[model samples]
Target: MALFFFLTAQSQNKDLPDVGIIPKIVVKAIGVNTDIQGIIKNDSNLFKTLSSELIIISNMGAKNASKAEQKDNFSIAPDEVKIVATKNINVADTDNIIVLFLIYEDEKLIARDRKELRRQKNDPNVSDGLEIKGLVVENVRSKVGKDFYDYFYQQFTLKNPESDQLVKVEEQLGIGIGTRIQIKVQEDLVFESFARPNEEQLVNLANSAVARVLQYFKQKERQKQLLRQF
Candidate 1:
């Protein structure tokens, strides 16, 4: 059997500069399980410290950075995601920026990544910018050449058009292979299917997830274009 769910929020940024009614953006960090605990293992202090780091990096030195904490609305579920924090900042006169994240385990640096930030400078754009943080997963149960275990669950987060909000999407499957299913799409989309049966299947799932995000934007653009034409 398989199951899936999603959540969304309507948030706004209050720190953007008023520049003669220039467009405003709701920057969001997107990925799978990018919470504080997801990056590190078994460390609370480190999680808090990294949480601060994420907020700072997302701000990109803008005067009005978000003071929200990282653990806000975050939970320990199979794959539940939320808008952990929100920042009201200016994006005027800046082409783009780069944010760096460092992941460590047991006081040792294990992984690192550089995130690129570029404003969406086109009409019909849902938000000004989208930040692709990365993906993190845990609790994998496997055995040598055997698929005889039990208890399987997975979760992920989806970014909505509104600022300071995230769509927590999750799925659960156990004991058998099943067909993929696309549940629904509104401000947020939820997709549930059987667990990946192989590496190729996993890649397909990842690609489908990315396509869903792109499709959301495309739908937004379609709405905007129709309104303009009318």
Candidate 2:
């Protein structure tokens, strides 16, 4: 009977729908704030890398959806893509921008996305309260990750797109992978009261956020796989 049950379980597993249908996605372009030189360059690079990773996952999901459509003998439209920018935080009185991509179909929303980088501060003594600033910044980054994930999930559901595979692709891609890239202040623009803040701290914070996002994505994907198995 034990062997019989084991064989039954194996059969059940084989009967389960495969979650491997999701295709890889590629990210081409991400939008950023153009006002600050330091912020813009760093953010652009960050988004570019992020976009490429997401594209791989999205393509996976899209492939799954396309297959489903083909099986049903229906047409699937191309994903609607757009990049959105918003001011989510302020540093030294300068607003920090959050850039994200949106994938949707017609009036329906599909996926909401973002890659964030902090804006450079011009204020003298900005680094004086580094401890306090760090704490606040950390919290902000956490919130950003949570918000981003929630938005993506919500949009994904709304679109009702074919595949649930790429939901957790963020984890596999290492969303926040490196040190916070900082803008160099020109020597001629130096302020006597200023102390240069360490960019490494920001980079660490960014990496932590990226790690969280990746984990979140992986978790979601696992959940979807479980659902399909049943």
TM-score of each: 0.31, 0.20
Per-candidate Cα lDDT values, in order, are 0.33, 0.25
Clash totals for all candidate models = 1, 20
| Worst 10-residue lDDT window, candidate 1 | 144-153
Q: Estimate, for each residue in 82-144, the C-alpha lDDT of model 2 and write its tens digit.
A: 222222221232222233333232333333333333333344433321111001111113433
For candidate 2, the per-residue lDDT at 194 reads 12
TM-score of model 2 relative to the true fold? 0.20
Model 2, C-alpha of 130: deviation from truth (Å) = 34
TM-score, candidate number 1 = 0.31
Clashes of 1: 1
